[model samples]
Target: MTSRRSFLKTSAVLGTGLLMAPNLYARNKKYIGVQLYTVRDAMAKDPVGTLAKVAKVGFNTVEGATYTGTQKFYGMDPEQFKQVLDDNGLKMPSGHYMLGDGMPNAKGTIANEWQKAVDDAAAVGMKYMVCAYLLDGERGSLDHYKETAHKLDLAGDICKKAGIQLCYHNHDFEFKQENGKFPYEILLNSTDKDLVKMEMDIYWIYKAKQDPIALFNQNPGRFPLWHVKDMDKTPKQMFTEVGNGVIPFKDIFKHAKKAGLEYFFNEQDICPGDPFNSITQSYSYIKKNLV
Candidate 1:
């Protein structure tokens, strides 16, 4: 029998013709954004100035990565941050938040502070609030993931009432197996489809040796957000600028419709040089080739 990777490679090739049709390629006009975490240092120093630079670099949207203890966005209140984004012609459709640790108290319901995070995200004109990461302690067995899924569903209901959606962003750890089962699969199976969605990080999934196309095929329309980072060709597979790497982004993007991709952000966890320059490089490549 063929391996899953082999099957995906063959399917990707066979599906190319269908994805290349005029109607399909036309959908590439959706807004391209950058995850602000790429410029964390600059944002911490000066969010207003950083946002201005992001707009100047031709990014139409951004995904925020700073929202912790203070319950504020980049040192500014939600209203103030929204204004900064608007002034620079940028919009934040989604933002990352921690949902496991302090979010829920002993009662298993969302704490007041977590509710504030949800409210602030909506106030800032965000359409999605993503639970961005799962700490090591939070991941032990499949049961833990199932409990997390339940918590996510509850959080999703809170977001729904505020006219926003709640999603989960993945790194490579979710792909690790425990007792012959994948935690990623457990989360997908346990969570209600309407309640919790996924933000697929292409680079990490590739690093984990998983087939994105296969996941998309298995759970069509479940992935609404994508982190479009690239992997270096080196043995370590370090993160690299989009077009300078080995990932087949153009081919993967051809299946955006099936993936339910609403917005995609360029995110490089570590930049070799200036983050702004790195993001500009990725932006230029996407504009010239992928988009």
Candidate 2:
């Protein structure tokens, strides 16, 4: 059987000689966006097909989650991936990158060939590049976060030159206090406001026992991106589709203006059934209620 990657390569080689309609997805004004990582398995198997399904489920925008390892977007080079997005009428305004300390061998990360990464991001029309997460080895003391913040500012400078904003996406660990100081606060304070911004993960913040509204009020306009997910009400607090959990999304969304949110992506790290079904449900709820 022809592998999906092989098929895509062949398809790319045989150009259709077609042009995408100008501003096709932009004209549609699709408000709902999803993180491509939500369907990681499917993306690994067939990114093109998965993206088509994502569009069919009513998501007009997507945030990419992989680039460093292969220096490609879902096995396709930047140009090819951009064409795939255009073919599906989807826009990718943001993508997740890494600091590279954890993956010392990884390329195209903030610590490696970051300029090339920024350039590729620009080619794909991305406005923001996010520091996805800090691996366990990368996080230790408050000083580590301070160092990470400095790195973010440095990377941000490069991204700024390419018309991209650099952001930090937090997990629950950032909220944990190290020597009585919250690493999250250290990050917010240590980085340049214009260069380094926040991409608040709603589920993680809530899980950490912090209030999103309070964070927005405290640092108004410092956040430009958000990872939207929900936590079930069970004791374990497993992941659930948006509006099917106790995250109080309506209340959190009310402060989007204060948060300076430009784009938000639905990202459920785990799901109960088909990831597509979970995202579809989230998209429907967000479209009907949250926007």
Candidate 3:
């Protein structure tokens, strides 16, 4: 059997070439997005198809990963890639950027690099450019996070000109306590809410044993994006299909209006078998139960 990745490649290009009108999904209440990383393997093989399948699954929005070295959308140049989304009736309102990295000629300066990312995101009509991850030492200390907060403020300014916002996505590390408080708290308190925003990954917050609703309560309207993934039942905290894990996703979403959730994406860092199946199951669960 051909891998679903391969199938999507062949099917996507052909389907798109046929100039089929994009399918409509439950836009308002659902508002589900896909973290492109969840389909990275598929996208690497066939960018167009992977995206088409994502659209087919009823996702209205996407948060992107870099498509190969192009540092652009889905391995195609800007126009071609935008056409793909248009042809598929999809929208990418946000993107995961290599924040504080990827600058040219600075000999290890991250500011210029993040500037380029903001420029690209703006060109693509993305409202948000999100700092996706942090390496081992790159996370830095609370003070370093303070510095990052400042950089984020600058990035947010650049995006502001283009009518975009910059946000930070978190893993478990931000929850690490320091001086009787969470670094996440430090980041929240230090940053300008109007400028530097958050894309809270719900799974990671749960994994770190924090309350998503409480986070929302403490910092109301700071979170504009959410990675609505769930955690497995076991101690390992593996990413499971949404609503299939111990995380009380429904309860969390009950506060969505107050949480200021503008976009939500489904992401699983690793899939148990076929990643697409995991996605479909997650989509179905969200559509039927949560959305």
Candidate number with greatest TM-score? 2
Tell me the deviation in Å of residue 243 in model 3.
Answer: 1.8
> Where is model 1 more than 4 Å wrong at Cα?
1-28, 102-112
Q: Which residue pairs of candidate 2 clash?
A: none
Report the number of the highest-lDDT candidate.
2
Residue range 1-291, candidate 3, lDDT tens digits: 333233223322222211222221112564778898998899989988888899998887888878323556776666677788899988899887655343333311235555555566666778888877766666667787787778778777777877888888999998776654566666676777778778999989888777778666555566779998889988788889998899888788887755667788999999899889999999999888888
lDDT of 2 by residue, 1-291 (tens): 433233223323111211122121121224579999999999999999999999999888999988988899999989999999999999999999988998889998999999999999999999999999889999988888888889999999999999999999999987676565677777877888779888999999889887788776656666778899999989999889999999999988887776677788999999989998899899889998986
Whole-model lDDT, model 1 = 0.82
- Poorest 10 consecutive residues of model 1 by lDDT? 102-111
Candidate 1 structure quality by residue, lDDT tens digits, 1-291: 444454344333323333434243233465889999999999999999999999999999999987865677898999999999989999999998776454453221243466778888888999888888887877778898898889889989888999888889999998777775678877777887768888999999999898887877656667788999999999999999999999999999887887767889999999999999999999999888888
| TM-score preference between candidates 2 and 3, better one | 2
TM-score of each candidate? 0.88, 0.89, 0.85
- Cα displacement (Å) at residue 160, model 1: 1.2
lDDT minimum window of 10 residues, candidate 3: 17-26
